[model samples]
Target: MSQPHLSSEATDPASAALPLRRVLPAFAVDVALAATLSFSTLMLGLFGWAVWRGIQLAQQHGGAPDAHALQAQIGTPPVLFLIVTTLVSTGGTALLLYVWRRRATAAERRESTRRLGKPSTWGWALAAGGVTFLFSSLMSAGGRALGLDLQPSNLDLIREGFARFPVFLTLFAVVLAPLYEELLFRRVLFGRLWRAGWPVLGLVLSSVVFALVHELPGLNGKPADSTLFLILVYAGMGAIFAWVYRRTGTLWAPIAAHILNNAIALAVLQIYGDAPA
Candidate 1:
């Protein structure tokens, strides 16, 4: 499921005519796949830990660990949980992508090769990343001007998580998250909707959902007053990703852009050490 380098076909009418319904993964299938992955990760991670603890306890005292002991162990040494969950999620996503690609139609395979064979695909992806940074910065500045505290509430959680498990959090942010996210938001939501002849609706709906998912967690420990502004900012970034995908005619375009954007954020977090994202 690969296409030849047809660099000039980036804007070809035939490329636009590719049957996305036949090429793109079904929305319902993606949703079900995501749910299955999530459930599997949780079950496997927790069950594995429980069994290990039980074995250790049995060996030590000829009985399983008590509930309190299990609870204490779960959080005291979190390395096992973190590693297991990360491996499951990342590996599962990769396997799913491989399966989908293997099952793709010839037209589906061609979707990514139209313009992506040239260096210009990376150029467009990087441009999208840059635009997203500028747009988000401006949105934050404007919110402050309007007397809204638009600080990202997830920053503290991210910092804490990184402190506890740097490798897992970094991998999740810079790679795994972007892969499935771009697939769902850009490819499934926006691309499918646009291909179904609803470009405007696709753009707006996908952006809005993307924004909500990114910003809603902030509500857990912060004021809800800035939620609207933060959502708008993130939605704008999502829109930029969608725009790049549309412009480049490949899902990889947005995936690359998203990864770049997150990698930049990770770098800033590293350099600034406890600074807010």
Candidate 2:
């Protein structure tokens, strides 16, 4: 009997053409991979702490302490481990891009930049804003029709936190969030899907995923209101962002819009002191 052959060519080209298929699977996989890698990194850090503690214990009492004692001493948030893992992943991606650049022709580099760095039109921003308003209005109307409360929550924590850390909040809202979120949702997720030719599907799928990611623990708190409704609202917002990115072929417009929207929302919450239930 002939040996079985495994090959990339064996995969369906149609599946490859549908970027949504690739993106959805990759999104799921990435989340799982990130969690696993983060946990592993945290465990490694804890092990290093235990070993260090062993040396300290040996110096004082000639032996390592019990595992229970070590666990108590080394207990710390996994945030540092997550940060380290993110840095490693980012560095690795940069290194890979650098390696690819060394081999790529000048024309290829120019084309790559042309594709990635194109500026979006002002009209695209207007369209995005319009879409956002319409979506928000529709959701509000739906909530009213269903007799569901559709008011913004009192963002007391956010308001207080921002007051305490104005500079940090500004940096996070205006700079960090726009840059990272646009890159992740627009450039990577949406762009990949658009390139694969499932522009509409990719737009919707990426938006939903972006909204869910925002809801994950530590990044943001769980919604007290209906999670489904919140997801729909966020997904709608994500669609607007994706549409802006798609129409303009530039990430800056969507980033600006996102930043502006967030700043406005924050200001509203601070001024009005949250909506009454």
Candidate 3:
């Protein structure tokens, strides 16, 4: 449920390993748990907003001079509330992952014993970061060759908000996000796919899914031709992450690389541009 299909003592020896069969259902369970926790976090945020603005909303509805004006006065959710909700969601996820991993069956616990070399190294992390940048740039250039008018990522907008509240964004972008993502994408998805006898195919499938999740939402008003380009870039990045995970035999490698990538993206937005700044 947590990671690589590590065998128990007297090891399954890889030949008789049924890791794919065992890990699939475990992954489904983890996804359901994460989703439920995330959903609950969202609901709590909404509830908090309602509590904070309820009286004002009630006053507005009680025949204010202008309903629109009254609602506008409420503005958006407070940045503090945003900070709180993020903490809740991420904290909840981490706590849940820990709980399930501990309570899991002996087979699941065996994931710890599957270690290859060192779980992670600073060297691998930095190389992965470099790979991310190079591959993404290559894909972007290829996209341009095809007459696509690609735009900067929507990350600028998110980064602007983060700049104002550096603490929460630091935690979110640099720590929580990478950990959760690696757990879901590399540990769960990629591990199973690889164990299922998909080497090249596993890498491609996992990377494509990872990239789509990031790219699709950002494509709303973007030019059509740029779609494939973004997917390629993101997928390439995901592939790098998967490779790093497999290379290190731990999630730390990808998480470190991810944090570096996100940190760079935020710094660029802070230094060069970003309308909100």
The best candidate by lDDT is 1
Write one digit per residue (lDDT tens) for candidate 2, span 1-277.
2211101111122344654455567645544543465446556766775676567765675566677775676555343343344444433332332232212334433443464444445556655755665576677667657775555332443455467776766556445555556655665556545656677877887787776754442334444454556567778888898877666555556766776666655555568664211
Give the per-residue lDDT digits (tens) of candidate 3, residues 96-202.
66445423246534543453334445588788976776666566666777877555454644655586878777777667767766666665556655554454555
Sort order, lDDT high to low: 1, 3, 2
Output the TM-score of candidate 1.
0.69
Local distance difference test, per candidate?
Answer: 0.66, 0.55, 0.62
Best by TM-score: 1
lDDT of 1 by residue, 1-277 (tens): 3432212212333434445575344544554565577557767777787677667766786666677875675453265355457557645654464456223345655766756786888899999987777687677767788887665765755676688888878887788777767765666566555665556666887788778766775544546667877888888888889888777877788888888888887787789663222
TM-score of each: 0.69, 0.58, 0.69
Better of 1 and 3 by lDDT: 1
- RMSD of candidate 1 to the truth, in angstroms, is 5.2
Residue pairs in clash, model 3: none
* Residue pairs in candidate 2 whose N, alpha carbon or C atoms collide under 3 angstroms: none
After superposition, candidate 2 runs with Cα above 4 Å error: 1-120, 126-134, 137-157, 216-225, 275-277
Put the candidates in TM-score order, highest first. 1, 3, 2
What are the candidates' C-alpha RMSDs? 5.2, 9.7, 5.5
